[model samples]
Target: MYIHHSDVQVVFMFTERFIRYIQFEKRYSPHTVSAYQSDLDQFTGFLNNPQKLSPPPPPVITHPSQITHYHIRNWMVELMNQHIIARSINRKIATLRKYFKFLLQEGVIEINPASKINTPKIPKNLPVIVEDVKLTQMLDDNEVFGTDFKGLRDKLVIEMLFGTGMRLSELMGVKDSDINEYEGTIKVLGKRNKERIIPVNNELKLLIAEYQELKKKQDFFGNNSLTLIVTDKGANAYAKLIYLIVQKYLSYISTQNKRSPHVLRHTFATSLLNRGADLNAIKELLGHANLSATQIYTHNSVERLKSIYKQAHPKA
Candidate 1:
C-alpha cells in the first residue's frame, strides 16, 4: 500500500516522455494525442487509488515496470463493471499497449504488461449516411444558404466534406494554396501527417472560388492566415464551428439523428461505392490507412441494392 517518491516521479516522467513521443515523433493528430494521454492518466490514477480494488490488496504499481498482464486484466474488468463500452475500452487497451511498448523499447520495463490483455468485441454498426438525393436536394436549396460570406462558407464547408470526404481535422487544416483550380484536387494533411489528394468536382471548385472571393472582400482577409475556413469575424474556424455548420445545413434535408461532419463523409463514401467506384479508389480518396476501413461502405452499398431489389423484383 506504500510507494516511494522516486517511483512515482519515474512513472510521471516516463508518461510525459511517452506523450511527447506520440505527439511529435509519431505525428499523431492533436485529438488522438490528447485521448491517448487521457487514457494513460486514467490508468495511472486507477493504480494509485488503492481503494478502488476489491478486498484483496493488490500490488502497488509505482513504476511502469511493475505493471503486468494481471493488472491490465483487472483494469479492464473494472472498466467493464463501470459500463464502459467495448470500443472505448479497446481504445484504452490500445493506448496502454502502445505506452508499454514504448516503455519496453526504452528499457524502462523488462516486459510489456498489457501485451496479453484481451479486449471485448465491439458490435459492428454500419456507417450512417444521408441519401444522395436528399443531400443533393439540400445542397441545391438556395434558401438554405445565402450570398453572404457566412452562407457561402457554410455551403462550401458542406460541399468540401461531401465532395472530398476529408476528416474534420483535415478540413480545418485546409489552406487556400491547397486548392488546385486547374487540377481540381485538394491536398489534405491527414492522420499521421500523411498527405493525400482528393479530386473535387467542377461545381465544388467554382463554389470554392466564389467563397474565396467573398472572403477576400472581408477585413479579416488582410490577415496572413492560410487556413481555408474562417469565422464570420475573419478568424480561423474551429471544429465546433464546422460541426454546427454541417449539422445545421443537413437538418434542412435529412431527419437522421446523427448529423455531423462525419455523416457527410460517410455519405461521400457510400455514394461513391454505390455508383460503382472501386474499393481501392474509395480507400485512397478517404485517406484510410487500409482497405479494411474502407470496406464498411460495401455493407451499406449491399443494403441499398437489397432495398432496390425488393422494390423492383416482380418474380416474387
Candidate 2:
C-alpha cells in the first residue's frame, strides 16, 4: 500500500493541534496528555503494521480521516490478543474517541469513526485500604519512622496522603506557600490545574512544621522550586520514591496485596465515610471532579458495616 508524505503530515498536524488544545485550552496534566499521545501513536503503529508475526503487508492508513470503525475494531481485537486488560483497552478507545471527536468538531472529518465503538466492560474491583487502627499505630510508632530528615519526610508523606486524601501528583505539587498554617488548610492543585483547599488537622500542621524545620537543617537545594517534598539530595521528590515510601510503611502494617500511596488515599476516604463524613465533603477534600468518583469509598464502608453486623448480630 502506497502512503503519501502529505497524508502523513496531515495526520501529524491534526494530532499536534489536538495535543495543544488538550494541554493549553483544556488544562490537562502533562501525564494525561502524554497518555493520549501514546494511545494515538499505538493506533497509528497498528494501522501501519497490523500483522507483526504474519508478514503479508498490512493495510496502511496515513490520515486520521481514513480510519474507519472496522480499523478500530481490528486494532482492539489485536490488543486483546496481546493480552492487554479491558481497562487499558477502554482507555485507548477513549483516547481515540476524543481524538475523532476533536477532528469532527474542527470540520476535519464529516463523521467520527470511533463514535460508535463500544468500550469494554471493566471489572469493578474495590480499592485497597489500610485499617485506621493499624495505620494510627504505625504513625505513632517513632521507631518505625525514625527522627532523621528522611524518616520525617517519609512519615509526613504518608500522613499528608492519608490525612488529606490528596493524589500522589497533587501531594508532589504542593509548595510551601500552599500550606496555610493559620487557616489549617493546604491548597492542592489537582487534575487539570484545578485548585482545592483541604483542611489539615492540628497534628498534621505540626508535622508539616517539623518537616519544614528538618528540611531547612539539610543542605536543601530547591531554591526556586517551592515543592514541599524533596529528595535526599534536596531536589524535588519523584513518584517512585514516594511509592517506595508508602509501600515500605504499608507492608509493615497491612498484609494487603496492593500497598501504595493510592491505597492510603483509599484508606483516607473510607475512614471518612465510616465515620459519617458527607460524600460531597470527601469529594472536595480529595479534589475529585465529581461525586461519583468519591462514591466508590462507600462500598468499602458498606463492606465494613456488613462485617461488623455479621460478627455482632444475634442472627448469623
The global C-alpha lDDT for each of the candidates, from Candidate 1 onward, is 0.87, 0.86
Best by TM-score: 1
List model 1 lDDT by residue over 145-233, tens digit each.
98898999999999999999999999998999999999999999998799999898989999999889888888556886678999988
Candidate 1 residue spans exceeding 4 A from truth: 1-9, 54-60
What C-alpha RMSD separates each model from the true structure?
2.4, 2.8
Poorest stretch of ten by lDDT in candidate 1: 52-61
| Candidate no. 2 TM-score | 0.89
- Displacement of residue 209 (Cα, Å) in model 1 is 1.5
lDDT of 2 by residue, 1-316 (tens): 3446676677789999999999999988766888999999888767666453233333554667777787788888899999999999999999999999999999999999998899789898888888889999989999999999999999999999988999988888898889899999999889878989999999999999999988887857345547999987788888889999999999998887799899989989999999999999888888888998888888898898999999999995
User: In candidate 1, how many Å is residue 280 off?
Assistant: 1.6
Give the best candidate by lDDT: 1
- Among residues 3 or more apart in sequence or in different chains, the pairs in candidate 2 whose N, CA or C atoms overlap within 3 Å are none
After superposition, candidate 2 runs with Cα above 4 Å error: 1-10, 52-59, 219-222
| lDDT: worst 10-residue window of model 2 | 50-59
